[model samples]
Target: MTNNLSVVINSDAQQVWTMLREPARIAQWHGWNADDQEAEINEIYFGPNVVEGADHTSLVVDGGDVFTLKPVPTGTEVSVTRAAIDHNSEWAAWDEDITQGWLTFLHQLRFALERHPHGKRRTFFFSVPGTGGSAIENLGLSDVPAPGDPYSLTLPTGEEISGKVWFRSNHQVGLTVHNYAEHGEGLLIVADQPAIADVRPDGGSLAIVSTYDLGAHQLDAIRNYWDKWRAENYPTSDPVH
Candidate 1:
């Protein structure tokens, strides 16, 4: 058996295309959970993660499907035309699972990346699925490691983060994010060590770190600081979005 579906996103063609290729973003719309996302792009030919020096997301399970993606005039054309599906023979039938899941994740990706676009920095967190650590989710301070602390921020990712205005190097800000469950270290794996700038989509210089090279002290600061920043700068996430 085979399956294919598409949804037109209200975003620029380029932005839609970019999200299709990003495993992190793709997993959100396609993976099991919205709060925790992890998927890597891969090549079917060799089951390789990298192809021609670039990476792709793939899920090749026994009796799984291979999905081929492309950008078409209509939208990002995703063809399930490739891959073998065994239904009960190879894998369980998860049609509703696939249809609703991928479409939703793609829509969110369209909204986020299209308007914001790159050249600016953005960060998101993905927790270990079903790991309901109070500190991890920031559900209540009673369970949090350093409640009522400054320079710490809890993110959607499993990474507990923290940052501080460095007293040295002209107050060059520093940050740390910890991915305890280790799903691609949240979004930190992209690019080099956290990039710091005064870019003002969030008003003035809010330090955005790449989370790749963070340690304990740095993670502490992000966890402490996130609420402070959200309280002061932006609105909290929508209950639904």
Candidate 2:
């Protein structure tokens, strides 16, 4: 099957392979920290559900989803091919949402390896139903500059941020902020989810802000600001940490 999501990380295949295999390295790019994060990782990645190739280049997780790595001229090409879903399948209903999630995580992996390979990350996540608009629109990022172009703007919370465009897709955009972490490096990803009829009538929006080596007070302030923003913008949807 064709890859459902793919990214070229600016690192060697062995490095990417290490990240895929080791739990510690996987934590660098996978989901945010939570009370059950380690348990969830073990169950999904190292448990009975995972199958690894002898050469360590391919992995099959949770039955049908496959992760593969190959060396390329630029670096390493990492790809994920999701299991096919039939109408009767349990995942058929949330296929698109799951695809979007893969898209986000793949980019996060690329960012982790390319930008902050060894740094511990602290993330602030916000996912809420769309109110006919998005965080991209609210942040005035509708007319985005080309990737690597520098940008500076003041957030609704009165914080001024300056960064460069990292990447952009049809429904998502990522930016690198210079003032977020101790070493002045961070990533902000904004995604717009389309309405899925009965499943997600109002659609949705997701924002993931990843900071490395950020002070506690600064992180808390950032979280509080976005939390308030989510509440005011989409009061009906419950806030997600």
Candidate 3:
């Protein structure tokens, strides 16, 4: 019915409060589908077009709940004591979703406090054939970053995901794997000829990818192909990554 979430943000309460007041900043790490619409006044692309870290200047992460933040000598105390009817109802399907959402948001807050400029993260999910066709459900690596460690990624824009990836060989495809970290909103890693080719992020490029609507059998294959390269070139040395 109600949940209480709080964290000791590395930055002062004033900085955290400033970020919360910004609709766009809220959306980068916590907005739902509300930030997809191309608003009239705000004119921010929202709703399905909602990318986690695209631009929080407007809004995207309005979870039907209103948050109240207070300052503490140590850091800040953010409380979510009240929310919309939908968030309070038993029909809430994403109880766990909120958990993930809050953790991500706090991470972003911490990042902004530590670094001069704030960063964001977006994570994508998809599946591939374990043996041939049975996709591995929840390998537990969907929301991670480090490889072989059940990793996930986020970009400066938003999150990207593909639950079922069709397996294939030798194909040229431009895709992006959303990475999650303190650097920025999301890391738009292109899915080009070289899957997981360690491609550099072209921040100037206007191209974007959304994590919710992506699907492909070749998705996992691409990751696998990337894994192969990693195995060959960046072999494990001390199992520390």
The alpha-carbon RMSD values of the candidates against the true structure, listed in the order shown, are 16.7, 2.3, 15.4
Ranking by lDDT: 2, 3, 1
After superposing candidate 2 on the true structure, give the runs of residues whose Cα lies further than 4 Å from its correct spot: 1-4
Top TM-score prediction, candidate number: 2
lDDT of 1 at 181: 14
lDDT of 2 by residue, 111-141 (tens): 8898888888888787787764777888777
At residue 89, candidate 2 shows an lDDT of 78
Residue lDDT tens for model 1, 1-241: 2123333444445555455556554443333333433422333222344232133323232224444445556555443322343456422344433433333334334433432334222343222111222221232222223312334655443335543311111111222233421222222111111111332122111222333334567556554555443343334321111
Q: Rate the local accuracy (lDDT) of all candidates.
A: 0.33, 0.81, 0.34
Judging by lDDT, tell me the better candidate of 1 and 3.
3
Give RMSD (Å) of candidate 1 vs. truth: 16.7
Q: Report the number of clashing residue pairs per model.
A: 29, 0, 51
